[model samples]
Target: MKVLLIGPAGSGKSLLTRSLGEWLRRGGYSVALVNLDPACGYLPYKPDFDIRSFYDIRKIMRKEKLGPNAAVIRVHELLSNNLEKILPELKIERDFILIDTSGQMELFVFRETGPKIVEALKDAVGIFLVDATLMNPIDLVTLKLMAQVVRLRLNVPVVPVITKVDLVPEINFANSAQLTREIRKQKGSVVDLALALNKSLDGFDIPVRVIKISSKTCEGFGELLSTLYETYCECGDLT
Candidate 1:
């Protein structure tokens, strides 16, 4: 299955891609790592297919005389235009293909490139990573909303993953009811807004199975793998 690792900058997408790919390989699964981030300077694992070889962001910045942000935008434009070039590389047989996306989440998901790329793959599942340290009830609601938006934009199945679990204490919110109660304890109009949004999201019947993992320690890898299988198969059975 093709799994796209997507999240905001510093949310551990690349690290998770590296660690997860390594774990899968060690388990005797054939995994291909694809780096789609042109602005990323260093990656923990070498991608079998790297976009920089096609469109270098630094070269775009130099040639177009654009700033860092503008150059990134230009890179996405190039990616959208030249997507056909990368599709063949992704067609090879593999048990899993883990794609690391751009660090700036908006540059990828909000742009035309993200959906186009996913449509090309046709069988891709998105793993939307949320930083565990940012998991206050209000922030969690906000992230869930963002994940929903990403799913809507891409029109694909996206699993919300909590990354950096080692940095935070155990998260024990059993359901949206627990989350709503926690939000009510906070004192702010923002908290009220979050409550309303959370309720609306619950009405949609989105099953958010929280899979927390620590890339540094490889904790929760098994649960993550099972969730991926379950998501891809659309069945409860992991086998």
Candidate 2:
């Protein structure tokens, strides 16, 4: 299965990509890593397919005389246009294909390139990482909303994962009711907004399964792998 690791900057998407890929390989599963971030300087694991070979953001800035933001936009534009070139490489047979996206999440997730790439991959599942350190009830609600938006855009199954759990004391709430109660304790209009948003999200199949993982300790790798397997097969076969 093709799994896309997507999240905001500093959300540990790349680190999770490395950790998850390593975990899968150790289980004797064939895994392929694809780096789609042209702007990323370093990665823990070398990608089997790297977008920098096709278009580098820094080089685009230097050659095209564009600013960093403009370079990022331009590189993604190039990627969208050149999907045919990249798609072939991604189509190689493997037990798992892990794709690490750009740190500039909005540029990718909110734009056309992300959906286009996900559509091309067919059965790709998105792993939306949220930094656990930012997991106050209000912030968690907002991040959950963002993950829904990502699912809507990508039109695929998405798993919301809390990353960097080691940095946080503990996840505050187990369910939406607990989350709402915690949100009610906070002050300001933002709390009201979070509460209303949380209510509006009711009845929709939002990801409620908590998969808190720490790439540092490999705390939840087994659960993550199992979740992915369940997504891939209704029978939840890991074999």
Candidate 3:
């Protein structure tokens, strides 16, 4: 079983990947933590395999004289061609493999290289983490649209996870619907924001299972695993 934790900057992908690795290990499952983020300078947990060993984004930036964004694109393009080699290094004799992805969602998600990289994994599920405390109503709308884009782009099982719920426990699946009602009754600036979002929401049809998680307190951690089991894993598999 392979689980890829993905999110924007400050969305706790690395932390959750580390925590879940520990959680699964405690449950008697052998877990291998793989860091797929070439841009990660420091990691809280030492991964069993790290992509920085092969591709260094900083080195690419300095050697090629490319900006951060351009360097990321270059590295990803190289990985897309070298996935056959990279996939072997990531493989290990473990029941569960936790993959920590780049914080830059578009650098991997929007590009063709992103899906190809994910396709290299065997039995992998993508976890999309959203920072609950930082998201506004408009951000929530954009997330829904993004969920659709990611799902369609990757053609994989994408799970929507709302992280850091301890900071703001009010946002979740209901917030999206509640915000829709609130905005319908608003005008001026609020209505203007809604109009802007409506254009982006044109073709959003992805079904999102928004589960809240607090890594600090481990609140909702069990529920998150349960949902993963029900949605992605076989019976009694990856439990």
Instruction: Name the regions of candidate 1 deviating beyond 4 angstroms.
Output: 235-239
Model 3: runs farther than 4 Å from truth? 172-207, 233-239
| lDDT by residue for model 1 (74-192), tens | 88787777778767876868999999999998988998877887787777778889889888878778777877788899876677788898988577562678888989898877987
Could you give candidate 3's per-residue lDDT for residues 30-127 as a string of tens digits?
99998878888789898999888888888899999999888888888998899888777776989878888886988888888888887777457777
* The 10-residue segment with the lowest total lDDT in model 3: 230-239
Against the true structure, candidate 2 reaches a TM-score of 0.90
- Candidate models: Cα lDDT each: 0.83, 0.81, 0.76
Q: Give the top-scoring candidate (TM-score).
A: 1
How far residue 16's Cα lies from its native spot in candidate 2, in Å, is 0.5
As for candidate 3, its clashing pairs are none
Residue 205 shift from truth in candidate 3, angstroms = 9.8
Candidate 1 — which pairs collide? none
Per-candidate clashes come to 0, 0, 0
List TM-score per model, in order.
0.91, 0.90, 0.82
